[model samples]
Target: MSLENHAEFKLSITKALGDQLAAALKKLAPAPLAMENIRALRPLPGVYQLYKNGHLVYVGKADRSLPQRIEKHFRKISGRRNISLDQMAFTCLYVDEDFGAVAPERLLINEHRGQGQVPWNYNGFGNNDPGKRRDTTEVDEGHFDHDHPIDLEYRLTKLPSQCMEAGEALPLSQLLQETKTHLPYVFRYQASKEFDDIAVEFPDAETTADEALKTIAARLPDKWQITALPGYLIMYPKIEDYPSARRYYRSTGVVDVW
Candidate 1:
């Protein structure tokens, strides 16, 4: 096996220490899967996701504590706990973590479920979709399973004037753009950290702490959406909802939405 595989193989031996693992594991955990271009902004608000293959397994919000949130997922991955996704690749995506507070994280969870992007839970959600009506047609777009990437230029803030006033059936792109601009500071903080890596730098402890809060404040608008989606990185919004969106996600036994 290659050196990386060998290391994980060696570490698996310590799995026997289940009872004492949590605490010890925390200190011994490896650094998170760092992102590319993670030095664009000051520490601020954002959302993050952990993906296996192109599918999302977990989503989280960072309210100025991007590193800490990222670390949480890394520690979970490193622990001896059972994890069995089809692909093991891991990468992170960030938006405004405020998305967490505004909407239910489960919304993102449901989005992925609707897309058939995430693997079915062990309870057999995947196999149980008998009618096949509940299944999402696998699309050709890459990472759509997790991030649902769209044209970045599609501005969400400048909603059609009449539609904005009436709150009519506005397009998803308009909604997103509005949300992004309404919370520019938040998105800026988010994009900055992922693209810039603010957490790894900054010498003053107080300054670092302040920047973290600024990030959180900047991202409040998007945090509402993250609250809806749960653990998905949110490349963008989905065009259609899954037929079994509610059933699959609601039945998955998720706890309170964060």
Candidate 2:
């Protein structure tokens, strides 16, 4: 079959399944948020749906004990205190084993989202959804094939004077050791805005520029200060050259052979 036909068939099956599930869920009476109702919840793994004024608001799964998880939602221990239980009600389906809750939760979330029902639930309920995939084999090979060098850069504010004392540039070993001990999250350093500054980079897909800057700044010593330059690029030598690379740079000094 053509790819388009295959896709349509799969979508149809998914829609049918979702419709059946939604119908079954609607038949399950919602329980109140009172102490007696909460205590009556089973301790088995399950999928729970929260409703506000008869509208589905959120769907969640508990792999261990359903009652404990539901209690946390009510007591605000799960960081959901903002959710008022005064008009909220819930319904749950107990699963025999923990893994059984996974599909039901995902399906319920997807179904509710399709119907525009759960505005409070962010990005559906599945944990294993593999988001966008990219093929980077050619891109990676091209970098090495073209000998295209890349340097990561970080901007800074309060650089320590002791690290750049005259004729006493810090050794790469010490810098690396200190980094490993205090700033292990820093994976690479490429270039700096100033000779005294160093750069830090993180996976663009996993972290935002602000998040990376905050994390690196928090991990650094109080004596040092770093800043984030969202769109700036600087060049430096490869990390492997660190063994012989100057620990600090001085524009006036005779360049060291590395």
Candidate 3:
């Protein structure tokens, strides 16, 4: 059968079962799963299911209030075109503590799976087993080390007084151009006891650290003092060093320094 036809068939079965199903579900005191009524739900930990046209699509447990959790889901679907709040319904059972909701949620997911319901509980719903840890004793731990020697160049600039006073330092996300702004180099912003610091990054292969530093230096305003550090050194300056400053080569594989 076509996917659309299968969905229609399921919806038909749901409609046919509507009166009986509503009668049965009403015994559990299920709610209409609408925004206006969400605040009326009990603010306790619980397990909830999302039904699309009476067909179960998702099961979730809430460690907090069921109302808050359900409201979040409502907001998420509100912005989506494929899903609609009008076709969705929810039923929840309150539990005492956060942890108590887990087992019941797992049991429901397992029961649905065994019955071929297949609610979207993909990661083995509520499976808390941490899984075995791998033995890394024989593995050269050095291979995983990010500090492997690579030539690193850096540019250090003094923070403007307004930025220092307001503590409005740039975040790594902004420096990496994750925001709308783009910069020539990746840098980490730091606020120290002595002065505010920004450590520029030099990735391997593309541009030599020295060349990158010169380019950065040329672009920076004259009010800022620029300095170069010799090799890769992670900064952990003492509190007494307040403004202690040094630049170090950040290795190629280094993912995050913060």
Candidate 4:
């Protein structure tokens, strides 16, 4: 019995594997992508689909933990405007760990791309901050942040240790540096020693980060201001027009000389 005919079995199974994974993921019932639900699930290796308003918007693969990767998406959405956690959901499937090398995500993405749009993957949804060098460039017209920019009105809580008490003076530099750590979104600022001499306070109770910026500006000398870019915040020593900014903050009160 000689079975040398290999055409029946393709050596490259990447596409077939991707199709199988995609089909499996599509069959799983979507669960709320909220933190509470994600935290409850044990980490699993697999491919997943993210839906916005029940429409499939993204596909991803987690070689190690499904909960951690999806949790990141939840956090990313929580800090942006024009979107809500209630409108988001996800479904996933466990793939064998050995398949991680074939790039399961690419497989899933390719399969889904043939079916419909995977908007987030192309719009830089999972990308980190583009950094200060790219700040001046306009965000791609249809990018995720362009469509649902960061919410300056997003409240601040669980602040880092460097945060100061309401009405308590703290160096502006330290305050800005520490505040960004807890944020689910990006906050960038120009570094300056001058910020060390400036002291600012927080609201009596937890409040919007935008309000904090307003309060911080109250003590900053002339020319120091905070600009609310579409996707993040930037504090600089001088007020210059930022074409990409949604708005700007300035000294709304006279700095106390005492």
- On lDDT, who's better, 1 or 4? 4
**TM-score leader:** 4
Q: After aligning candidate 4 to the native by TM-score, how far in Å is the CA of 11 from where it should be?
A: 4.6
Q: Identify the runs in model 1 with alpha carbons over 4 angstroms from their true place.
A: 1-42, 81-100, 119-258
TM-score, prediction 4: 0.83
Clashes of each: 45, 3, 4, 0
Encode model 3's per-residue lDDT on 156-215: one tens digit a residue. 222221123233444322322321111112222332332224434322233333444343
Model 4 is weakest, by summed lDDT over 10 consecutive residues, at 249-258
Alpha-carbon lDDT of model 3: 0.43
Summarize candidate 4's per-residue lDDT along 1-258 as a digit string, tens digits. 987765665576888887788777767888988777888777889888899888889988887998998887887899899999999999887778897899988988887787667888898887877787766777768888888988877877776633555567777777777667666787777777887998676664567777677777676778887777767777778877665777777886422111
lDDT of each: 0.32, 0.46, 0.43, 0.78
- Superposed Cα deviation of residue 216, candidate 1 (Å): 42
TM-score of each model, paired residue for residue: 0.27, 0.40, 0.38, 0.83
Better of 2 and 4 by TM-score: 4
Q: For model 1, how does the per-residue alpha-carbon lDDT over 1-258 read when each residue is reduced to its tens digit?
A: 645544333553233322222233223323235432233324655544456654455544566666565544342233211343223333333445544454323444444465564443322221211223323433232222222211212222322322333323433333334344432112211232232221222112222212322333333333221211211112212223442121111111222221
Candidate 4 error regions (>4 Å): 1-11, 160-166, 252-258
In the range 1-258, model 2's lDDT, one tens digit per residue, is 645544333356655755666777788999876567878977888778887778887788788788877775563311121234577788887765734634767777788887788765663222121221211112232221112211222222223422453454443333433332322122334423342343333223333323333434433333333311111111123211222222222222222322
